[model samples]
Target: MTGSSHFPVRGIIEGFYGLFYTAPERNDLISFIADHGFNLYIYGPKNDRQHRARWREPYPDFIMKQFAETVAHSMNRGIEFCYSIGSGVSINYASEEDFRLITSKYQAFYDIGVRHFMIMLDDIAAEFHHEEEQLMFNSYAGAHVYTANRLFHWLKSLDKSCKLSLCPTDYHGRAPFSDYIHELGKGLDQEIDIFYTGPEICSETISEQDTADFAAAVQRKPVIWDNYPVNDLAMKSEMHIGPITGRESSLPRVCKGFIVNTMSQAEASKIALLTFAEYFKNPDCYEPWPSWEKALKTIAGEESYESIKLFAENSLYSCLGYPEAALLDLLANKALFSLRSGEAASVSKDVQKLFDYLDSLDEAGYHLKYRMSNYALRNNLVPWIEIMESLAWAGRRAIAVLRALENNEDITAPLNWLKESVSEIRRHPKRYTGSILLPLIEYVESKVD
Candidate 1:
């Protein structure tokens, strides 16, 4: 790693901004981040306009005050807060009230010591806007920018200096981000910051050209909002982050800071924050990262990639269809997650024992340990199990079906799983325990033979 190209981060903000509404136990999550070395936490509110549910209502006065408590707690620990409002009112159509509402609320955040503001444009829409402009407006954070920049200018208008960050609709997080770097950084330089995630690795060796292209596109250093993979929250399968342990070593050397997005799954926020910290603080960060050896030690209790995968896969399975969705959201950070549940891994060889145990379950026709019983397993738990120590690809599909049943959610996925499970048992008699897995056996047995 070249010292010169790598703009050393003086302080780090291993962020886990909430994309959804606040979680019930947010108080615990905030305390965890401060204990770690995170400098910022982006509180981006979700749909709260309805003024409803437990935590779903708009940032209630009490909630915002509590949010302030977390920020103050972070400040005492040296962390900063970034208030990111919605991206809905970006175009010319939004009323002045929307502007007043956002700014006034934002001022509340400012009163709490937030130094940075991120305007997300892609989320807001203008019916009259063209796709290109729509994309561009999204990139610029639409009318929110009008409010934010107006806020920026207002603060500056009042001679107050503040930081401005924008998440465009596209570009910054795309494969072609570099192709439009200059444009992506337009009008938002000096004080403006770019926060983004992408479908491809912009910092990989093989994707050097793309990385370089992306680096050139932002015109200024961008902040990394590294996203963890997620399907549906209800599925047990959407549990783990992929094994990109080495990814931290490859981020664009030019990035100003990175916030490993922990989304709504705030409970495990500390785990994600710690992973990024270890990688960034240590120079040979990736080469040994938690050392594949030690990471493995925790993964399978015996230092091997296979053991680690099982720990992740099965744990994911256990978490499958867990309700409180807030839990599912945080568990998405599969990358740094350790899998084994009760044992302390003292050596690498122990992992084989763990897998062997799982294998024994499979042999005994005990598929619950696999995906058969969980949504995270994608239907046939075998596919997830076989690859637990090998792949996380099946996770791409949402936990559409099983999760619904798990959560007692009314979504179509779970209902269909039940209907299908019954017909499936009849069509394929060899699948489950004759006593338990049989289709509606109670209903079938209650009638005359």
Candidate 2:
């Protein structure tokens, strides 16, 4: 039986809004989200006076005004705005200053048009073992509470209302899911309408059972910082990049809500999410989108998700400062296909271009030169090589289709390419570290051994 009813899917939204405030990127990003089907957009600009400095002071009026206009555009497009306020973002605020900063951040957002806001406390705190770090953690957690509680009080203090979503400061790197959940729940302002991640955000593995449990435990109307829409449940690399939707694990849940977090990696592939939504709304739409040409004018817009994603990958590595993330992170996410990879022929011609492109790029061992997104494909060569090796795997699949056209399946041509890739890895073992490379290495060693 299909597990379609495990979770009731909602219309879809976001908990974080990536920023490129120094230029026109932010404007482009917001418009992109609206075209796709996200109704909520959280504003988390990297650095600005409203967040980095004391709230008692004025934020540069021009930036502030422009930001408000951006929010207005979001609302006009039917998107809800969630504004983030705090100094920990820049890692430089003390308690009183954090209070001053977050308070103003929230107020500024609310004044503009935000009905939702997020308070990030656990993150600013440092290593708990260090006295100074512990002090920072405490101060940071307090400021979160100060902002959160005050937010509740402020709502009571005024007729204006909002839905407060708070994140535990130590969230990104924490374990003992229970402790994290408990601490977050204990400190949760009674007025808080939702918790950001709860216990379901996966960094290493995407387990349906775990998501089910997190939903059960967090009785509040749960809202998640859905990372599957990006890539995780493995190291922060791109081993098995697929599409942007988390269809396999998420479509069957009956819960509060979900807010996907888009980044430079997945935002460009917004169609993935829209495709996922169509399936969630009606699985037959599970069929691959016709084309970005169709999807962009219809769902994703302009370029196909494949081209947009490639552009993002090249943009990151070739242009953006954070050349550390990868495109595969966005591609290999299996949850995208309702957790199923359909027949290649079934996928749109534009969507299929990615595989064709990878198949053709020059290869050295398993590492092929991807020049699309600049330095954004920052995953270790291990994953890159694996995909390169998977060229062997991807090629095997391709052979069945190609062999009929041409006799003598000279898989050796690509196989030789694979051998060269393995040899390159052996030649530069130091370049490939960690446990990820082992499988690809062993796959090749077995050939020689």
Candidate 3:
């Protein structure tokens, strides 16, 4: 199978911690996913109390109605709607009452046309909390296996084709497999899919060998819960705007399928998600740069594509790595080195071009800040934009300082302006990933000092 058939399940999972999307946003996302060759949309926002903290309670009528409408909309677009409940937060594996509650909760979603269900045991305690549960089951994984098997059997009874995905408590780690995972793998029904986040929760890369090893250990092909383009958890400070790389082409063959966990900023996430769609469709032939360029053009549209691309280059630094900003950093280094080596005449044209690029980035920052229609993108990207704008200002000042040195003029004011620009860039709250400007700024500051 290739294209849509190759990856039986390729889509986005609304599995972030903070700020769940509004109903309209989710509906738009469903349409977006369907158009981009994605087939699944898992509704598993961590903050939804009824889905997690209050697992036994029914959603209020308004929320339930929204879910029904969303399900209908997803169906209209040829997408599978997977309703995920985080019942493991407080679920009692040994209690018949808890089992009934779980069934009833899923029944409600099944009534709303959700044929796919996910029970998320991630981020919950690994041990059996209740004394009764400890007595009933030998281990925590044993308890989860019991609940998941019961739920899977019930869902199968309702519809034999219904799919179930389980997110285990021990989802990510290297070596020394936890007893919980071993028991869950040994005990889980073959029909139930298991979710794994590779070797780490927010892994930088997921190799095919790692996935294959995990499959061997787990006795089933794990469904990759890819945490790329997701900016929650420890990555809350950075926005991941780069293309999806580091995943081997053979990943789809080893794992069940890949589902990207998107950022809170839906519009911005499309830049990476579209590339992910291309990768899922044909990882063997996928090229990150071309896919990323296409994604940028698609997200920003022709009118604003160039401008957004300039801004996106600076924001492309993520946990994955910073390939997009590599050329810019190289140019900055060359410009600075040329000035320092008294090769000003030879590097003049290159310096001019670099300055022009910086000016364009400043203008792009202005456009993204004031004129962009996507409020989520604008709001979520404010920190990076601030940094980019400052970098542009600093770059321009560096050029001015170089020109002044070439002309044998006093460079005090321009140097001060450069320092101030660097300071402004440093003032932003989030600066871990996208700091391409840091090296250039530090080099220039060293010269000034």
Candidate 4:
């Protein structure tokens, strides 16, 4: 399906490595995407054996029926359901039988009412496997170009309105285009869209200049395969629950829309996906924080918004970088500054306020664990909540120890509690990413010692 004015060609690609979404979850997500104005959904979970590992095989009857139903569901909602195949793992690029096998797979999906198609050659060995393929093609680029071009023509012959896209092996970088990309850019059909993930697979920012440079190298505007909020690979322990950042506003002018690589957790993914919709709809005027807060309120429900926000703020660290928790850090330092400057009496109220805030965060953690509607989010955040609660307990004990010392009362027990709480936080089983409390814990430890 082609992009229209009301809806950009933007969509979500279920392209994460672990834990494929269930059929129900996929259906729910499609509905969510339609409600939020996203126009496409690419079904390409990396772990789906048929989609990647066994790319040339047709789906079983049950699976095919589900996919057909999904395509119909998306069509009813004005969303294009793109079927993606990653056949590069074991395809004999030079063989006509291999081409026919791949074509047959696409034709099956085409019969299922899917007109949008993608061929993903990402994350495969760069070398050809068969001697015949090596002899027939000069390089890996030639193989991919030949396969993609052949498929493009075959699909066009069947239906001219069919949209085709490709994800090259060398899909990211700044300079010195790989022979694969260079050859594909020169030889591949220009009508087929190309997918790029900026300078790196999980890039910090996608700038207009960088995209323009990539477009120049590829001989076509790239459809950004944005990997924001996808915590697969080494980032599996983390959940990216923050607003999308670092992407410049003018990106749409240079690239052909984006397809967000969403997390496996469907419900939590909507938080970031909502913001992506906002950014794609009006890149020039998008404000992440406002969109983020609205998304939380809408997704988490008003009653549970504050608790979800409390958990989400701590989970904002992604491959791009940590979100600025400058205000909290500054307040924490200020409280310590008061103690060091011998102005404890003057800033006692501010210290109390900071302590209260931290305490409330601990309470919010409890609420998130027991009360939030999203079980996956709660499960993912349990470790972080434990850390936050331990830190809060430690912070309060440190304050108590300080107050005891100032008043010249017995301080041994509170000091020991502070030490134990700090130990609890440091020894927690799960390592939370981008912890804002670490610095505060360090400061408290210094003061207690």
Tell me, by lDDT, which candidate is best. Answer: 3
Worst 10 residues of 1 by lDDT: 389-398
- Tens digits of per-residue lDDT for model 4, 9-125: 788999999998999889989999998778899989999998889887788999999998999999999889999998888888988998898889999999989998999899988
On TM-score, the candidate that comes out on top is 3
Indicate the TM-score of model 4.
Answer: 0.89
Which stretches of candidate 2 lie above 4 Å from their native place? 1-23, 45-58, 88-97, 126-147, 170-176, 186-191, 196-209, 215-218, 229-241, 244-254, 265-267, 279-449
Ranking by lDDT: 3, 4, 2, 1
Local distance difference test, candidate 2: 0.44
Q: Cα lDDT of all candidates, in order?
A: 0.42, 0.44, 0.83, 0.82
Better of 1 and 2 by lDDT: 2
TM-score attained by model 2? 0.55
lDDT per residue (tens digit) for residues 1-449 in model 2: 23134323232333223433332555555676566555566654333445433434556778778878878887777767677654444443334664555566667667777777665543343423334444555644444444567666664454456767665554432233455454445566655744344334433333345545554443443445555444322323332233333333442443444555543343333544554445444433455334322443343233223433332232222111233234433332221232124333234342244345444332333222342232223332334444444443443333222332234445556555555654554554232122332443343334334
The stretch of ten residues in a row with the least summed lDDT in candidate 4 is: 1-10
Model 2 / residue 262 / CA error / Å: 1.6
Among all windows of 10 consecutive residues in model 3, the one with the lowest summed lDDT is 431-440
TM-score rank order:
3, 4, 1, 2
lDDT of 1 by residue, 1-449 (tens): 43324433322222222245344344454565556555566655433431111121246688677777767776776556666655444433244554565566656667777766666554333343435454445443343344445657755553365566766655334445432345545544457776655433222221223334455676666666554422223322333323234244455565666655453433333333455555555535544334433433332233233433433333332211222222222333221122123222222233323334434434323333432322222232333343331212112112222233334656454344434544543554121112221222232223212
